[model samples]
Target: MTGRRKQGFILFRDVMHVILAIVIIVMVVFAFLSPNKYAIFFPLIFLLFSVSCLLDAIKYFKNEEHLKYSFIKATIMFILFLFMLLMSTIGFLNI
Candidate 1:
């Protein structure tokens, strides 16, 4: 495990965090604006991201060497998981 690879991994996580935040904001806004079409798609995307985050967290945990930034990773994964649940609930209620 070279330093560059480790840095790349961290950067990738940061990128994923920003992308997920943007996605959630967009979906939430769209959900309110249309209150119809976005309601259908938001849950699907949220579920996908939540699954991805959970898998990534598993991988991070296995690599205990990077424990220093584990908190950030955990926070990001938790947010994704929560967002997924919220969106799913909203979708169910809308129906």
Candidate 2:
């Protein structure tokens, strides 16, 4: 991969990390402050962003040079997404 393309991928991955952190913080805050309506939305959004990150990671993986920089982040996001989905579903079911 060219230097420019590598830098771009790194930037994208870093941005995703930031987004994941912010969403998780918001998720926790909403879970504590107001668990009625908005709490569920945060998890759904989290799932969405995580899936996007995972797709990006897949792209990175498919490269001929086998860049794996984002692979760990993507896997973490996938795990988090699953957790968020399960909790959200349970919360809704209990409601």
Candidate 3:
């Protein structure tokens, strides 16, 4: 039962990673195609990264592995996420 549960968890994590990768790729492509609209997509990309880091932190916390490192990374990512979000909103409004 434990083995199966671990496998399931791994599968779920892999799926989430793949989805995030696809979304990031699409965002990058759109940002490149429409350079003028970078303000909108760039912040969104950071948001995704922040979420990914948060998820990693949670996983590491749960697994009792590298707690300090993961939490610190997540904290930094969240701060950057907020900064990018605020800046993008202001930029969008100005334009």
Candidate 4:
């Protein structure tokens, strides 16, 4: 890959790391902010979800899995990745 492409990929990877970590933190913050309805379940869910996404992402890199993989797996990973990314961005800016 070109230097620029390599750098972009690296940046994206780092961004995902931040997103994954922040998703858990944000959920915890919210859960504590309102333990009655949200409880710790939401944050714990986010944490578990992010871990799964990271694992799937790792699997893709290691095994060269492609679009042919199970749609559910791909969808879960993609949605979690995007959901955490969006929530993290909003949470970071709002708080």
* All candidates: TM-score: 0.56, 0.51, 0.59, 0.41
Report the number of the highest-lDDT candidate.
1
Alpha-carbon shift of residue 62 in model 2 (angstroms): 5.9
- lDDT value, residue 12 of candidate 3: 81
| Clash counts for the predictions, in order | 0, 0, 0, 0
Local distance difference test scores for all models: 0.71, 0.64, 0.69, 0.62
Over the stretch 1-95, how does candidate 4's per-residue lDDT look in tens digits? 57787677667766776776777677777788887777535645554565657656654553433556655566667677678656655544543
lDDT of 3 by residue, 1-95 (tens): 38788778878877887898899899989988997867587767766765665555545544545555766676665566566566656655665
Ranking of models by lDDT:
1, 3, 2, 4
When superposed on Cα atoms, how far off is each prediction in RMSD? 4.9, 4.9, 3.9, 7.7
Cα shift from native, residue 7, model 1 (Å): 0.5
List of clashing residue pairs for candidate 2: none
**What's the true lDDT of residue 60 in model 2?**
53
Q: How much does candidate 2 score in TM-score?
A: 0.51
* Cα lDDT for residue 82, candidate 4: 71
Q: What local lDDT does model 3 show for residue 89?
A: 64
lDDT per residue for candidate 1 within 6-46, as digits (tens), equals: 77877877777787777777777887888667667566566
RMSD of 2: 4.9
Write model 2 residue lDDT over 8-88, tens digit each, in one string. Answer: 977877787787768777777776787676656655654556555565555555456545555666566567656766765
Stretches off by above 4 angstroms in model 2 are 45-49, 52-95
